[model samples]
Target chain A: MNHLLEVNNLEINFKTYGGEVKAVRDVSFHVDKGEVVAIVGESGSGKSVTVQSIMGLIPTPPGVIKGGSIKFQGKELLRASKREMRKVKGSKIGMIFQDPMTSLNPTMIVGKQIAEGLITHQKLSKQEAKKKAIEMIKQVGIPNPEERYNQFPHEFSGGMRQRVMIAIALACNPELLIADEPTTALDVTIQAQVLELMKKLQKDTQTAIILITHDLGVVAETAQRVMVMYGGIMVESATVFDLFENPKHPYTWGLLNSIPNLEGTEKKQLIPIEGSPPDLFSPPKGCPFAPRCKYAMDICLEEMPGDYQIDESHSARCWLNDSRAPKVEMPFTLEKEKTVTVGGESID
Target chain B: MTKNLVEVQSLKKYFKIKSDVTVKSVDDISFYIRKGETFGLVGESGSGKSTLGKTLVGIQAASDGDIIYNGQNIKQLNKEMKRNVNKEMQIIFQDPHASLNPRMRVGDIIAEGIDAYKLFSGKDRTNRIYELLERVGLSPQHAKRYPHEFSGGQRQRIGIARALAVEPKFIVADEPISALDVSIQAQVINLLEDLKVSEDLTYLFIAHDLGMVKHISDRIGVMYLGKMMELSNSDDMFTNPLHPYTQALLSAIPKTNPRDAKRERIVLAGDPPSPTNPPSGCRFRTRCPHAMEVCALQEPQWKEVEKEHWTACHLY
Candidate 1:
């Protein structure tokens, strides 16, 4: 597989008043060319930290990438010079954030924001950049791009503002687009529009995407492959089908079961993960999810489980996947033969 | 069948921006919540679901409508009667962090309703607060800490405790769990379910997530541009949607299972029209996939299309 981006032993921590808060620990994943890889995790799971490190957006004073190797297209990002990093920031790799309201500049016009990246990275003239910015805005499904170009960020609604953010990110035509919860702030209908727009744009541009989100529904919709993160560690990485169908990790099972599905009848009970996400400040030893894992074993608590390869492209960091460990059924059986009462004698 | 706890009739809440221009946030919508049942009001942002919730709780004044709580119209209640009605209705806001006071301790925040009604005092008050905290899955120790100390989910629990303090019969939870993490959302949802059953409470659950609403709600009302597009039992609405807007909204929800590729998504063309200048006829006509000339020319009548299923669409 032609890898567009790769990270090895990515360790990131924050220097707090009391102690060093380990945000991302020994995380490694690779995004293939023209592939959409989703990094799914709850808040404080280090999903955002790993992506921020990719864009060099992590503030060094508080956020220090203690140890890691980030290679974008075989070029080392951490070791890249200031001048080189600038060239790579917007032109090679672009990023869109969760809140478009704050991510966008209040003082500047929306069009000018997109133009700035084009002018800086593509070395386009001001007028040319503005023209291209309008095109980029229209490409992201924003209507009346020419008229919208003159408006400030406040003039646009939440979903339109997100379109502007996408316009800016894709303006320079970067090879990789890192969208950190792009549709999280938008409403469901608008979220659907944005996700569809992203899928269409990805197909048209063939831009590899790194989607960081906590919603499993979104993972199933957009991602081809998924990396499940927990307590600053990658618990599982597999194709979306394999991850959803034959999930190996207990945490993944919990996440999959936690979400209420639209296809089936509303289950009487949603099997929520018993405990909250592990605290990063004093993260537990061994498996970070051992406390919440239903099939947790003695080895799971005593020592960290290494990544056990399930197939050529699938792997999970769980003791349950070990050959020596006794076979354990996944905590939640997703497709139970649900008997539909309303539909009469039908099985799902 | 349960009796109606609260009934809203032609509730209209419009905000005047200038001399003549007004934003019709909630324009003449009617719905009723059964006792001990969850009535879900779902719509995107600016669809007036929150405004309707506020109107139901008596927080926002209605332009013209009747909110019948128990037996009396809350809008027409006397000062004493209004105070008594206020004791029975409560609301949980969307942003838990902003809804809570930073300076006040969790105990004082939860006890605000208790203190207002003069329910308890001193040792009894403290015990009540402690019980409320523990009921919401928080410890008694949590009462001493400020709102900033608790996590987003925990803060929401405190909000629930505060709402439960007054023993409110009808609670309007406006996107209460939307701000929490996915895992924490289930915990808060489960807590709310447990409390509802134990306290014999009725809920007007307002949210934008259809899937989550379907799980908790017995009946659902789909709103579009301040108008009720579809209202039906949760299962019937999801299984056999009548309104085009409801169908689009249901299809918009992202499916979780990748293998079940049978579901087709309906991506709406554009964002909803501004409430200030809503469409002439059907509010959803501009975005409706099956829009016709009549749809743009005349407003659709809200009619019962099937047994216990009501919809506002020209297609029906």
Candidate 2:
């Protein structure tokens, strides 16, 4: 079966006064028709840059896609013409941004904003688009759609505006939806509502979602597969269960140990990953995380490790995964006996 | 029994936007912080948790009621006594980017309190700044650099160092780690925990992140629309939440392990009512799943429902 989207050896750089900053280096991944994939990383890890390139949203003067291949449904997106890419953007692929306040047009009616996409892509009449826009509003769980149709973005609350964003993204029924830190700005209760809505919409529409977030809990709650990115590189990719049960990369281990577990009774001292993220302007030739990795060997500092397959569905980029390397025990584990049911029910 | 370091009585902070319209950001909330304990405040955006913290620290003057520090009401103190009390309480704001002055060197910024209090001068002042830098996990070389030169986590350390410069007994850390990256957030949290012990400090830690708050705080308070909904020990708050709103809030947190059974979330209906015109009687009645008729007719009395656990709800 062909992947709905395939990204291979993507290398992106930005031109600054200092030098060319290698924003993304040799990152590769794929998404099935209805799969949910999460890319987890800290700031400057190139998670946003990788997704922005897929949408052809990167500014050319500052951002340069040095080398890569982005194939959506077997068609090469990198070499596509401007007109062709434009046709594929909103009609075939949709995106929801981080900040709802700044992303929406303050002057225009939100209902019109949702209708505009339908008119442009589906070529519906004005009246037909307006009717469908109200329906779309209702579909996203916003009440009193008829009255809300005439309101501007400023009139809507943050959560309601985000509902508007979701309505706009799913208005065209795009096969792929990209959400970049969609709930990071909202409170936990509000975040829960938005995540639930996104999950329901994905199920009903059968849309493949590429969720970009720095939150590990959000990843566990919503995604099936997880990709851990560090210093512009894809460090690890595994099923969410495998990733959480037995994370392979040192960076992944660091991330797991850093956060305080909500279910755990004892207050453990957080073992933070010492030192800061690597400078992208002059990315290290070897492992970018080597300087911070506690288990770093001489080989890790001198050479970049290749992807080592742990199983058919799991892979990690670390020298320690090599057969020749010494076996080391992970400092943390989520024991089966310790796992407590959240709210005590299956999500499905 | 440990003494209460700070006690608040019927504290209220209201903002008047129109002739008749008033935004009661912190309305009739009473609580106390025990000596050397970290009190966590959790709430949604318009919940006014920040306002309550500000009022306790005297950053925002309370419209009514009293704030008692070590049994002496702050409002009753004279100018000199008030100034001394002010020095013992300081605040670390949420945004690291906006809090520090960009033009000032980090050393001078940290020495702002040191100079104001006349605690040290010349080399002793410089050494004090250096000692603070190392204490928060920064090097002495960082003193000469400006705030713009450091990362979010490093800048927060500078903020912490400045808070400790005056040798304050209490600090209001308002969402200090919210702006940082995940790994960076951990580093800052660990730093705060270390400082609380070495400095013998009491913290009013205000944040929306429940997990971090639960990890750092000895006691926890839940706020909604300028009202204190519940207050209890951190462990009891999580394990046996009594308030309907508290239960919903705890259920809303995403699970850390994917394999764990999905939480049967008690999803509240609609956004929180606007603070400008909150619902009559109980502020949370409009969205409460268990709202009763009395909840809308009369406001619930803030009472101790169980030993050491307090909540304001008619259900009790």
Candidate 3:
């Protein structure tokens, strides 16, 4: 089945003073129609690069897409010309950045900013675009849409600015919305509201969303499927339930264990993944997570592991998944009531 | 009972932007940090959590009320006595990037406080800086490098090292981990926890992230628009929150488990009001789900609603 968006063998690099930084390497993923797919990773993990390349937003002088095929609705995006990319960018693909403070135009009135995309892509008249922009503002749950239409970005608060961002992204009713850490800047209550708004809008518009965030809780709440990235590589891809209940990669395990459980009664010591991320300037030949992995074998440091299919809906890149390797118990489990089993032996 | 390391009574910090317009950042707030215990302060931006933290550490002078440290009022302290008290209290800022001096070496940044108090000189100061660097998980070799050379996590470690340089009895960690990545945040949190025990330190842990604050703090206080809404034991506050604001704040946190994702969330409406002209009665009433007639008419008194649990709410 054809997906709304598909990325295959995506390799991105940056020219630096010291050496060429391998920002992203051999990453592959897909987003089905109206589905929410999340890319979870820390800083320098290339999650942003993967999505930025989708919208043709990466600058070329320092950033170079060495190899990849980004297909949107079966059309090749990576090789598209500037004019061709422009047509697809706002109309077919919309993006929300991390900071609403800088992303939105400060001088321009926000309503016109929302209307600019509609006027360009849909070729609507000025009056009609104005009417639609106000409607879009209202649709995003912003109060006093008509009054707010004339106001600048500075007039709105952080949460309201994000809401305006949502209004702009969904203005032309794009098929896919890419939100890069959309609520990372907002407070928790405001984040909850914004996430709720996005979910509601997604349900109404049937827009496929690619959410890029490091917060697992946000991923759990919104994403249907999760792609855990490390050292610019896709380490694990699984359904949200499977990712939380039975995460396969050690990197994923470390992420899950590090966050304190809000609902938990007992105060458990956080098991932080020791050491920092791999230096991308000269990335390791083997698994990017091998040095941090406690169960790292000799072969893990020698060669990069291929994708090991755990089930129909889950896959992980790790040497431990090999049949020859010894079975190891998972250090953490989300299922508090039941025993978790790995390779058939139950762990109590 | 454990002695209160620091006691704050009705402390107020107001910033005047205009001649007439006054922003009450920390308004009539009172709390105490027990000896060697972490007191977590949770609130959103513009809620005055940072202002209260700054006031406690003497970075900003309180507009009103008294701050008693070790049973002596800090306001009454002489210049010499104040200097001695200032050395005991230090702060770790939120942004690791902005906190450290860009031109200074990591070693000199850590030694600034040591030199200010004249606690050590020459070889002793160098050794102290090295010891602090290693204690926070960075190697002693890192002292020679500049702040620009380190990552966000490592820069935070340098900040921690600098704070520890003074050998402060009480430290105000103002959203130290908020600037870091999730995995890196845990590493720094563990470092702080370890140092708290070994160095015999008390912390005024201020952050918007409720989950991490709950993990580290013995007691937790919920602040809204420069007022303390609730205060209680960490576990009790989570399980049985009294203030409507606290309940909503707790519920607003996204659940990690997919099964628990659909749980009801009391998402507050609109952004928190500006501190310059805050709501007349209860500061949280404008956005609160359970706002009563009295909520807008009168400010609720801060009283102990339950045993060892304090709340300022009309519901109580």
Model 2 ranges off by over 4 Å: A336-348
Residue range B1-316, candidate 1, lDDT tens digits: 7788998898899999999899999998887888888999999888999999988888888899898998788877889989989889999988999999999999999999999899999999999999999899889988889999888988898999999999889999999989888878888888888888999899999998888899899999999889999999999989999998888888888788776534568888888888999999998988888999998899998888898899999998
- Deviation from native of the Cα of residue A345 in model 3, angstroms: 24
DockQ of each: 0.66, 0.79, 0.82
Model 3 ranges off by over 4 Å: A336-348
Q: After superposition, how far is residue B129 of candidate 2 from its true place, in Å?
A: 0.7
- Which 10-residue window in model 3 chain B sums to the lowest lDDT? B262-271
Off by over 4 Å in 1: A338-348, B261-263
Residue-by-residue lDDT tens digits, candidate 1, A1-348: 547898999999999998999999999889988999999998899999899999888898998889989999999999888899999998989999999999999999998999999998888999999999989988988889899999999999898999899889989989999999999998888999899989989999999999998888888888999999999999999999999888999888777766776665646666677767787888888899998776778888889999899998899999888879988765545565642222211112
What are the per-residue Cα lDDT tens digits for candidate 2 across A1-348?
799999999999999999999999999999999999999999999999999999999899899999989999999999999999988898899999999999999999999999999999999999999999999999999999999999999999888899999999999999999999999888788888899999999999999999999998999999999999999999999999999988999899889878887874677677788889999998877899998888888998889999999998899999999999989777667863453332211112
Could you give candidate 3's per-residue lDDT for residues A1-348 as a string of tens digits? 999998999999999899999999999899999999999999999999999999998999799999989999999999999999999998899999999999999999999999999999999999999999999999999999999999999999999999999998999999999999999999998998999999999999999999999999999999999999999999999999999988888889889878987775676667788889999988888999998887888999999999999998899999889999889767768855342323211222
For model 2, residues B174-222, the per-residue Cα lDDT tens digits are 9999999888888899889989999999999999999999999999999
Ranking of all predicted structures according to DockQ, beginning with the best and ending with the worst: 3, 2, 1
In model 3, the clashing pairs are none
Residue A310 in candidate 3 has what lDDT? Answer: 100
Q: Candidate 3: lDDT over CA atoms?
A: 0.92
